[model samples]
Target: MEVEGLSVVYKRARDRAGAPDAAAVRDVSFSLPAGQTLALVGESGSGKSSVAMAILSYLPAGARREARVLRLGPHDLLAAGEGDLRRLRGRRIAAVYQNPGMALNPSLSIGRQVAEILEVHLSLPRAEALRETERLLGEVQIREPRAVMDLFAHQISGGMQQRVSIAMAMALEPALIVLDEPTTALDVTVQRQTMDLLADLQRRRGTSYLLITHDIHLASVHAHEIAVMRAGEIVETGTYAQLRDDARHPYTRQLLGSVLAKDPRPEARPGAPAILKVEGLEHGFSKAKRGRPAVEDVSLVIKAGETLGLVGESGSGKTTIGKLICGIHDRQAGAIELNGRALPTQFDRRGPSDRGAIRMVFQSPDATLNPAHTIGAILRRALAIAGAGDPKAEAAALMERVRLPAALESRRPAELSGGQKQRVAIARAFASSPRLVVLDEPTSALDASVQKEILALLVELQKERTVGYLLITHDLDVVAEMAHHVAVLKAGRIVETGATRRILSAPEHGYTRELLASRLVPPAATAPARPGAARDAPWSAVSQLA
Candidate 1:
């Protein structure tokens, strides 16, 4: 597969007679040899995805695509008719997107979803397709293929769903597979295993891959060749070693410098008062059918101006613990104390002041922030609830604190970028002037540069307001940098707890060791003694333009 001089432009909605068009991809060129991987590395909206879609003939509606040459094996994708493109899409060229849940059919049985691909593309009999589906699942290293086939998409773990997506993509032994941020949503252990699975599949099937991601470390470890893109153009291209040792471009160098970098903030003072405390916390969905607790005897403390990171794999009860702290979930057996006073188990029982003191920033801002309301309206509502003297002034101040533009207040959530929406969420959380905030994977879904900015913002806010943070995340590196203390959770239990540096440097528990080992460290750096050894793309002015 090959592409040369690819350009994509989208016409924006015209309030006036003439509005400037957006160029998503411009003059981009790359080639992937059969059975090899070519990684496209950049921040969000850097044209990596646009290039992939151009090759797949899946550009968004009303977007104009122009390329000097675009070829997939023997087919000319640029000149192919719609019917031909449709026939080739699933049979020869396939794609696996960032979120498997969005792609998989939740209502359909996993077997039926996998089999439908074969039945439609290969015209296989139902029985034959079902058998093939089971075989494919097994090939993807899924145990109990038959049992899993009968389960719905939501019934399985995120890792399993992602593997199923990969299986479906490889159902017809496609020549190329487009993996767009495939492992971003997964846990560290799951991500490592999934990448290993992809490597194994590529070796066995001789399948070429176009891996699009903002994670440069992932690309360095996984791809044969890496391409660094910025502002819709490829600025650098080479092997990991070639680029790492001496990055010609300033942007590339910045990206390399941000990897595994340590937090720049000073240490928290000793003996800070515990703002929030949990004792013997235990909770489960069902009392009658429970084998193990959803959160088992979990106890933790968060001091003022400190961050206590809860790190674990999916279903490890990290989010549950966060919800328990914020009074979102009732604790069956536990004691929660805020400022030396026992707090109510349910949010409804909590007074307005109690509720205001413990605001939460949900992971998905889109779900929390109403799309129908403008940014200003959202902040104003929070201010009204908090009883701020001046709602409008306070809202503007909150936006300024998050480093968001004043004009953004008029735009709705849909008009903002992921980072911008997150900033708005942070602003809303701060509107109540909370002493403690439950931040659930606040930067997990964002690009690395944007993640850094958000982290910095959180740290700055902590310093100024002395707000405690209950940060729940799967990224160990983030835990290392942000958290004052760390807790390793598994099967709804706390397996280990200690200082962040000590836990990261030398973990006592085997599970903790496994978690650290599973981190996506670059092969070139045996041990990143300092930060920035395995950094993602560097912060760029152009990156914020997204």
Candidate 2:
């Protein structure tokens, strides 16, 4: 596969016609030999994904693409017509997206989704397609492929859903596969397993891969060649060792440096007052098979100015426990207390004070923030609901506290970057002066540099306000950086609980050990410790480039 001088531009909307058109990809060029991987590494909005979309002819409407030469195998991609591109898409080239849940159809059975590709591409009979589908599923390491055929996507675990996605991508044996952050949302163990499956399949089939992601560490371990993209252009390209040791471009060095920067773990404040407490918490979803409990016998405590990391795999009841405590889900059996006062089981049942004292931030800020509302309006509404004396001034103050510019107050959520949107979400969470905040996978979608900045902001806010945090995440690295105490949860039970350093360094539970083993550390972490190169660099250095 080869590309040279590829550029993509999207037309501005009529209302914004006065502004210049957006250049998503600018003069990007790269080559990937058969059976090798080339990684496009950058933060969100850096044009890595635009290059992929342009190659696959999958750009959205109003987008214009131009290229000097774009060829894959014997096909001239640039010359292919719409009909030709359609036939070539699933057969010669395939794509696996970041989120499998969004990529897979919820209403369709997993078998049908996988088999349809075989039938369309290979023109196989119904029975033969189904048989091939089962084989493909098994090849991707899914247990009981036959039984899984009848199950809908929602019925399977996230890892299994991703496996099904892989099966679909592999059904036609495409020569080139574009993996866009394929394992970003997965657990550490699941991520390792998924990558291993991809490697094994590549070894067997000699398929080339174009990996697009924000994780320099992941790209370092996976890609044969790495290209650093920033602000719609490729700034540098080389092997991981070359880029890591002697990068010439400042942006490239910043990306590498961000991954290597380590933060000191917050010390446990033994004398801090307990901000929130849960006892004998239990909750079960009605849709669950056999009425199984989603979370059972869960009990934890968070102290003022401290964070408690809840680590686990998908469906391990981490989010369930968080929701139960926040009154998002009514607990069947449990007791929640704030400052030694029992709280209501449901959010609506609680008084305004209780609601104001506890707040939660979801994983996807896009889903939580109303697209129709401006950032200032959202902040002001929260302040008014909390009975602030001056909602307008307090809203601006909240924006300032979150490190956002006051000018962005008028912009809607759609106008903000992922990092900016998350900052808004954090600001909204603090509007009510909450004593405890439940942060669910807050940094999973962000790039390494932005993630560090956001974490630093959270720490600063905690110090100023003495707020407690219940951080739920699968990223152990994040846990190490943020949490004072760590609790390992599996099947709704706490298998181990202790200091973050002790649990991460020396775990008592086998499950905890497995999670630790699956974590991917940067090469710098294992090498001789060097001074942090980007620690002193302003956050805007990365943010503006992104």
Candidate 3:
């Protein structure tokens, strides 16, 4: 596959100055033979993903208005008609994404989703499709393939859903596939496994890949070669050893530098009072089929004016516990107390005033916001609910707090970007002026550069307000930088817990240690912190790793 003289650009309206919109891609050039992998790496708008999508012949119709030349697998993608290209996808090539929600049909069962692909692409009969789907699931190491297939997309866990997507992608055994941040949203072990699976498949089937991602270190783990893109062009391309050993481009060095930067837990005084606490917490959902609980017998704590990071694989009850505390989900059996008060195990029983102390920020800001309402109204409602002072004034203040312009108030949710929506969500969460905030992977939806800005904003908020944070995430690297306390949960149990310093530096539990190692940044950069006036940086505990 090769792309030559590619020149994709976009034209947008200009101000009185009348300057043309910048080119989204420019004179991009690259080629890959069969049985090898190449990566396109850059920031959100850098056109890395666009090049891959263009190569895969899957650029959305609207984007074709700008693409100049794109060729792949015996077809000139820049000129392929809709019908011709539609027939090519999933037969000779396929693509997987960071989010399963984007690719998997929400209402369909896993069995039907996987089976239909094989049926459509490979001309398999119904019985044969079912058998092939099962085998495919097994090939990806999905436990309980039979029962898992019967489950709905939402019924299965995120990791399993990812595996299902992979199984479907591999069903046709295509000559090549494009993976766009396939494991970005998963935990360390799951990421390691996914990479292992991809490696094994490439060896077994000789399937070439054009992997698009922002992760620099892991690029070394999988690809035979890497092509770093910047400003819509390939600035650097070399083998893992060649690039890491001789990283020349300033941008390439920055990307590598990021991997080794120490993200010590969010700064907080070690002696500060506890902001949130839980004792013998228990929560469970009714099983559709039988005895297992969705979340069972979990316990944890969060210090006042500090961040408590919750670490767990998907469906390991990390988010559920966060939800239970914030009154988003009912707890079947448990005790929940905020700031030492006796609260219900469930939200319904919790008093109106009590609920005001804790707030939740969901992952998908787009789905959570009301499309019809303006940004101001959404935040205003949150302030009103929590009885914050001068709701309108607070809403405007919140917009500023999240680093968003108050002028965006009149625009509806549709007019906003993903990062903007999340900024609004954070503003809403803080609108109540809650003592504690439940951040449910707030930055996961953003790209690397945007992610840093959000994290910096979050730390600023914590420092200013002295609010506690219950940070629930699958990404441990985030925890290393953001949490003052660490709780590693696996299979509905607290596998490890302690001071952020001790836990991360000298984890006693095997799981905790593995999590730390996965998130471990190589030793190179010094701690970048504001050095709060509150106290010394007691929570900056990289020594735990040392």
Poorest 10 consecutive residues by lDDT, candidate 2: 537-546
lDDT of 1 by residue, 376-406 (tens): 9999999999999999999999998899999
Q: Considering TM-score, where higher is better, how would the candidates rank from best to worst?
A: 2, 1, 3
lDDT of 3 at 186: 78
Candidate 3 has a TM-score of 0.81
Q: Higher lDDT: candidate 1 or 3?
A: 1
For each candidate, the alpha-carbon lDDT, in order, equals 0.87, 0.87, 0.75
Structural RMSD, model 2: 5.2
Clashing pairs in 2: none
Residue 332 C-alpha lDDT in model 2: 96
**Total colliding residue pairs, candidate 2:** 0
Candidate 3 per-residue lDDT, tens place, 1-546, comes to: 666656555555444246665577777766766767777777767787777666665555445434444556777766778787777788767888988866799888899999998777778898999998889999999988989989898877677778888888888888778999988877777787787788778778877788888776566656666778787877877665566668878888777655523546645776777767786766667656375576767777777778888888777888888888877787777777677886776677777777777888888898899999999899888888887769888888778778888789999987887788888988887776788999998787776656667777888898888889989887766776688778888877788887777876788988777766655232222321111111221211000000
Give all TM-scores, in the order shown. 0.91, 0.93, 0.81
Point out where model 2 deviates above 4 Å.
260-266, 524-546
By TM-score, the best candidate is: 2
After superposition on all C-alphas, the RMSD of every candidate to the true structure, in Å, is 4.6, 5.2, 8.8
**Residue pairs with backbone overlap in model 3:** 263-481, 274-304, 275-303, 275-304, 505-544, 505-545
Candidate 1 vs candidate 2: the TM-score winner is 2
What lDDT is reached at residue 227 by model 1? Answer: 84
